[model samples]
Target: MAPPQPKAVAKPAAAPAGGVQKAKLGKPRNYDLGNGVVRFSKTKMFHKKAKYKFVGKKNPKAEKAKKPTVVVKQIGGEKNGGTRTVLLRRRRSFYPTQDKITPRPHHKTFSKHVRRIRPNLTPGTVCILLAGRHAGKRVVLVGVLPSGLLLVTGPFVFNSCPLRRVPQRYVIGTSTSVDLGDFQLPAHLDDGYFKKNKKSAKRTVKRKTGEDIFATKKEKYVPSEQRKADQKLVDEAVIKAIGKRADKKTLRGYLKAAFGLRSSQFPHRLRF
Candidate 1:
């Protein structure tokens, strides 16, 4: 009909002054404003600008500020029932004085009543055996035990004292003391140290000999006879160094005089 009148064409809406067109929903409005709550826009094109900018925004609820504590002080004889005013001060830090600090319950306590008796014998001191099979024998003190006992040795020369422990009371201290100038013996050496060294020396010799025959094979051997022989040699050397050519009777007499023992205390017959 009449060449079909063209339909009127509608023009698109003009954009706003700031070059950003208004949202079809309306101006971006915050439903929750004063409560500090933020709601994101559901539309893909909406991007709301923040009202206030902060370099580093920290949450107030995340870390609570600590309140300062108050301390009270009273002056002018408050405990004596005097009229005194109380003063309040903020306590930043506390440091206790010596009088205010309590002592530890497990602190070590000292007592004058506690007594410790030391042994009369000392190393290099010559002493006479008063009891046991080696009684009336001359022996040199080698070590002192924590139990107040004495370790004596004759070096297997004077009276066959073989590194034995004797009670302090059973042995009499003598005035004749040997000077240990070059001879060094530890004050607290155990009996097993000497025996073990002697055994090791003997075993080392046998190991050297076996190593020559079988270079690849290993052997664990201990020769008891050789150990005894080595120990005897060591004892003899020690004895010769201590007193050369001194007879057993002469040593006994010298020790007896050092101990100031009377003739009645002497043994009736020499056992060995």
Candidate 2:
């Protein structure tokens, strides 16, 4: 095979002789001229708060006409409608107790309703942030908690919970209404940590067994009392084979004595 061909390099894009064109420049920059300070610029200054009166078409048809007041003639019907002649007169009444009056408490539960919100919250459900610095402010529910915590935004959630109770309302899935100016945050995520983590993950080696995952050693099987006794006998036989001074008959007698087993009469003197 011939020598491997070198990869072709990309040429840098050259600008025109006049230099690179710039993007559309927005309104001119503003300078806050403090006491004994003045700022001058070669470019024209633009007024941000400059009011412009829009002189456009004023459609006569679009103007709303005021409805004429209906003056009802007093044909004896005015007495029934008028509230001026109303009088408060007690007919018959008694003190109403719990038995006489049905007490209705305004108890509302947010089990299935109060949910986690993200991006933004819905407009309808009222919200009083149970946590964070914006805790007191009631806001309209603007988002759903697909995974965690409730989300509320706007002013309504504040008004609904006068006592600073649970946020409630209808779920209105609408467009996001996040005021960028009110609360500012980074426009994009920083992925330097993410890239480093990915490289570390690639170089990582997995455990051969589940036991390696834990710091402490796994528990081994322990024989019961009965099983231990049987194993002891087997161990004694093995030890005896290796020239140990182990006697099976003597071992049984020793076990019986250690276990407090006793006979009322001597075994040699006992009759059948």
Candidate 3:
């Protein structure tokens, strides 16, 4: 039993001393493969992805050499899928025909239902014209716009209602707000200043002189002298803000009265 007393071989493990925690490669560190020569290697071809014990265990041949030959394929293999398409490089239609375009929407879809504006439609508010071509008239609201649209005006020399742009849910707001003291509005009354030219200089001059564009004569809408000098500077600044309002004859008799509804009127019990 005295012959088994010569076995004591436990030595290595003392190489970790440099910064930021990455020092594990402990043993087999020497190589000189000049022509894979027989010198003294010890790494079986360097590191051989070296490991000592649980070097971060797990290996079915390193998980089959780390997978990914481009796969995300689960279209018809549908295991709970709605959109996981990774066609990933199967090349071969190198432009022999269909170059494709016009598909659309990868972006631009705004105006999300935004037509809000009428909290008593402000800016000098008088409002009444409910639906177009001056329905039941009374205009005034002067300018709100940024796409919410109100800008009204009957200041077309009293009641013809010219400086347009309607939709504050088709106007109506009334407890008559007017004052407009220092006036302001005209920075070119925008909404592209009531944008009209939908290309009709008499149907483009009768389509460039070939005439008889439906026997001419219907091109009527003639307002421009810069739209009569911007409706005479917005009707002389709304007659100087209704002549310093002392209810200026009930605001010109509520814009020449005609907004009907008299059978004991009840537009939601009309407060305005």
Candidate that scores best on TM-score: 1
**Residue 265, model 3, lDDT:** 83
Candidate 3 lDDT over 123-168, as tens digits, reads: 8888788676679988788777677777777777677778788777
Runs of candidate 3 with Cα error greater than 4 angstroms are 1-26, 29-94, 102-105, 109-123, 126-139, 142-146, 155-159, 166-176, 179-215, 219-245, 250-272
Give the per-residue lDDT of model 2 (tens digit) for 21-118. 55666753455477854465333332333323334645576768965444334434754754343224433574445566568895565544545443
Q: Is candidate 2 or candidate 3 better by TM-score?
A: 3
Clashes of 2: 17
Model 1, residue pairs in steric clash? none
| All candidates: CA RMSD (Å) | 28.9, 38.0, 19.5
- TM-score, every prediction: 0.34, 0.14, 0.28
Go through the candidates in order and give each one's C-alpha lDDT.
Answer: 0.58, 0.37, 0.72
Q: Is candidate 1 or candidate 3 better by lDDT?
A: 3
Ranking of models by TM-score: 1, 3, 2
Off by over 4 Å in 2: 1-123, 155-272
lDDT of 1 by residue, 148-227 (tens): 55777775644556767787778767665665446554443554544443232222333656455433434555646644
